[model samples]
Target: MLTLFHSPGACSMGIVFLLEELGVDYTLAAIDLRKGEQNDTAFRQMNPKGKVPTLILDDGTALTEFPAIAYWLCRRHGAAELWPDTIDGQARVLELVEFLVASIHMRGFTFLAMPQKFSADPAAQDSLRALGRREVEAGLATVAAQHGAALCARSRIGIEDAALFYILVWARALGIAVPAPLSAYAEALLARPSAQVALRGLAAG
Candidate 1:
C-alpha cells in the first residue's frame, strides 16, 4: 500500500532496489523529468521540492529525500539487513550514505550534469564542472578507502551500497573513470537478482 514517485534512470532507482530487497509490494508512479512533470501541481502538492524518490506511506505520510526514505524503509523492514545490527555499524552506514547522497551526488554530480544551474556564463559552468570532477574523484577515493563496493553481499545489499550505486551510475555516464574496486563492486551489485528486477520494473514503468 505504499506508493513511490520515481523517475527512470534517476537516483530513485536506489529506492526501487530497496523496495525489491524488502520484498514489499508498492506502487510505482512514473514522473518524466524531461517533461517537467515533477513541478506540476499534483506532484508539488505531494512534495513541493519536486524531487524523485517521493514515498507515500500507507497512511499517506509522504516522505522525500533519499537518506530519510532509505533509513525508514530499512528500519521498517529490519529483516533485510539494510540496517546494521550495532549502533556503530548503523552510524557508519549512515555516514557513508550521507556523504554519497549529500556530497557526491548533490554537490558533485549535480554540477556535472547541470552546471548552468550554478551559473549562466559558459566559462563559469565549465569551471563549475571541473570543480565537480574534483569533488567526485575525491569522494570516490574516500569510498575506495572504505571498501565501499564490498558493502553489497550475497545475503543482503546494505543501504550504503545502494547509495554508492547511483553515484557510480552517474560517473560512468559522464565518462569519469571509476577505480577498479568500486567499478567491480557496482557490476556485481547490478548482477544481483533484486537489482535486476528493480531495474526491469523501473524500465517498464
Candidate 2:
C-alpha cells in the first residue's frame, strides 16, 4: 500500500483530498512539525528535504512535492477527472498549482508563519511577516480575480481545487480577507464528500 507522510493542516492536506477523491487506498503517517519531527533522521531518510506530503510507493520509492504526487496519482489511477483533458486545460491546471504552491504557500504563508527563519533580529522578523502578509494578500487577490468565477462553476472537484482549498485554509488562519465569491467557492469545496473524508482522515492521523 502507498503511505503518505503529512502534517496536520499543512499543504499535504491537499494531497489527502486528492487521494480521497480518487478513492485510492493509502496509509497516512502524521509528521509532527511542531516538535521538530520533520528534522528527525528517520524522516530525512525518506525525504532529504524533510517535507510533508511525501509519498512512499509500494515499490519503495519516495515521491515528494504536491503537484508531482497529484499528477502521478491521477495518471496511475486513471482519474482523468482530477485534471483537464486538453492541452490548454492541463496547462491551466499546472499553472494554478504552481502559483498556489510556490507564490502563495512558499513565498507567503511559509514566510508569515516562520519569519524567524528569515532573520535574526526581532524587529526584522516582524517586518518579514508583514511583507509575507502583503504577498499573501496579493496572491489571493490574483487567484480570486482570475479563477473565482470558474471555480464557482465547477461541478466536480479537480486537482487545482484541492490546492486552492489548502491555500484558503491558510488564508483563513492568517486572517486574510477572502472575496465573497471565493469564500463561497471554498465553502463548496469543503462540503464535498471527498473533502469531508480528507478532513476526518487528517484528524484521525
Candidate 3:
C-alpha cells in the first residue's frame, strides 16, 4: 500500500485528488502543520525539509516532492489519462509543473507562510513577500494564458491541471489573491468528483 503524508488544504490535496481519480489503493496520513507535526523528529525522518505530501511506497521507500509522486502514481497504475502520452505533451506537462513549483508553489509558500526563514527584519520579510506575491500572480497569469482553456475543455484530468489546481488552493489558503481566470480554473477543478472527495476530507480534518 501507498501512504501519503499530507496536511489539510496543502498542495498535498492535489496528490490526494490524483490518487482518487486513478482509483488506486492508498493510505492517507494527516500531518497537522498547525501543531508543527511536520517539524517533529519522525516526520523529519520522512521529509527532512518538513514538507507535506511525502509518499511512502509499498516497498517502504519514501518519495518527496509533487512532480515525482504524481508522475510515479500515473505510471505505476498505468493511468495514462492523468498523464500525457506524446513527447511534446509530456514536455508541456513538465514545463507547467516546473513553473508552478518554482515560481508559485515553493516561492509563494516560503515567503508568505514562513517568512522568518528568509529574514529576521520585519521590513525585509515584507518586501520579499510582496515580490513573491507579484511573481506568483505573474506565474498564474502565464499558466492561464498558455493552457487554461485547453485544460478546461479536456475530457480527463492530467498532471498539469492537478499541479495547477493544488498551487491555486495553497495560494488561497495563504490569503494570496489570484486573478479571475485562475479562480475560475480552480472552481472547475474543485467541481470534479475526485476533488470533491479531497475537499470533503480536508474539511473534515
Candidate 4:
C-alpha cells in the first residue's frame, strides 16, 4: 500500500483525487501544514523540501512533484485513460503538466508564499499581486483553451488535466480570481464522484 503525506486542500489533494479515481487502496497521513507539522524532522526526512503530499511508495521510498507522482500512480494502477499507454500520448500529457508546474504553480507560490520577496513597499506588493493575478488569469485561460476543447474528452483526465485541476483548486483556495472558462472547467471536474469523495474526505479529516 502507498502512504500519502498530504495537507488538506493542498496540491496533494490532486493525488488523492487521482487515487480515488483509480480506485486504488492507500493510506492517508494528514500533515497539518498550518501548524508546521511539515517542518518536523521526521516529515523533513520524508521530503527534504518540507512539502506536503509526499508519497511513500510500497517499497518505503518517497515520491514528490505533481507530474511525476501522478504519472507513476497512473502507470502503476494501469489506468490508461488517466495516463496514456503510448509514448507520444504520455509525452504530450507530461508536456502540458510541465507547463502548469513551471508557469502556474511557480507563480502561485511566489505570490502567495513569498510575497515579501517580490517587494518591500506595500504599494509594490499590491502591484506584484495584481501582476500575479494577471499571470494566473492568463495561465488559466491557456489551460481552458488547451484542455477545454472537444479533443480533451478523447483523453479523459490525463496527467495534464490532473495537474491543471490541482492548480485551479489551489488558486481558488487562496482567493485568487479566475476567469469563467477556467472556473467552469474546474467546477465540472470537481463535480465528478471521485473528486467529491476526495474533497469530502479532506473536509471530514
The numbered model that scores best in TM-score is 2
Order the candidate numbers by lDDT, best to worst.
Answer: 2, 1, 3, 4
> For this target, which candidate reaches the highest lDDT against the unseen true structure?
2
Q: Residue 91 of model 3: what lDDT? A: 88
Put down candidate 4 lDDT per residue, 41-151, tens digits, no spaces: 998988999986789998999998877888888888845466566889777777778878877777854575556776798888877777766777778777777766543
lDDT at 89 for candidate 2?
93
List, residue by residue over 1-205, the lDDT tens digit for candidate 3.
9999988787888888888888889998999888989999998987898987899998887899888888888878746566667889888888888888876777766676667778999999888788777777777778778777776667777766568768877766667666666677788787788877676555431
Each prediction's total of clashing residue pairs, residues at least 3 apart in sequence or on different chains, is 0, 0, 0, 0
Residue 56 in model 3: lDDT: 94
Q: Indicate the worst ten consecutive residues by lDDT in candidate 1.
A: 196-205
Please state the error at residue 87 of candidate 4 in Å.
3.2
lDDT, model 4, position 73: 81
RMSD of each: 2.6, 2.3, 2.4, 2.9
The residue ranges of model 2 lying beyond 4 angstroms of the native Cα positions read 200-205
Residue-wise C-alpha lDDT for candidate 2, range 104-195, written one tens digit per residue: 88998888899988889999988889888888889888888999988898777777866887888778766789886788898788777877
Which of the two, 2 or 3, has more TM-score?
Answer: 2
Q: Model 4 compared with the native: what TM-score? A: 0.84
Global lDDT of each model?
0.81, 0.84, 0.79, 0.74
Model 1: lDDT to the true structure:
0.81
Error of 3 at 173 (Å): 3.8
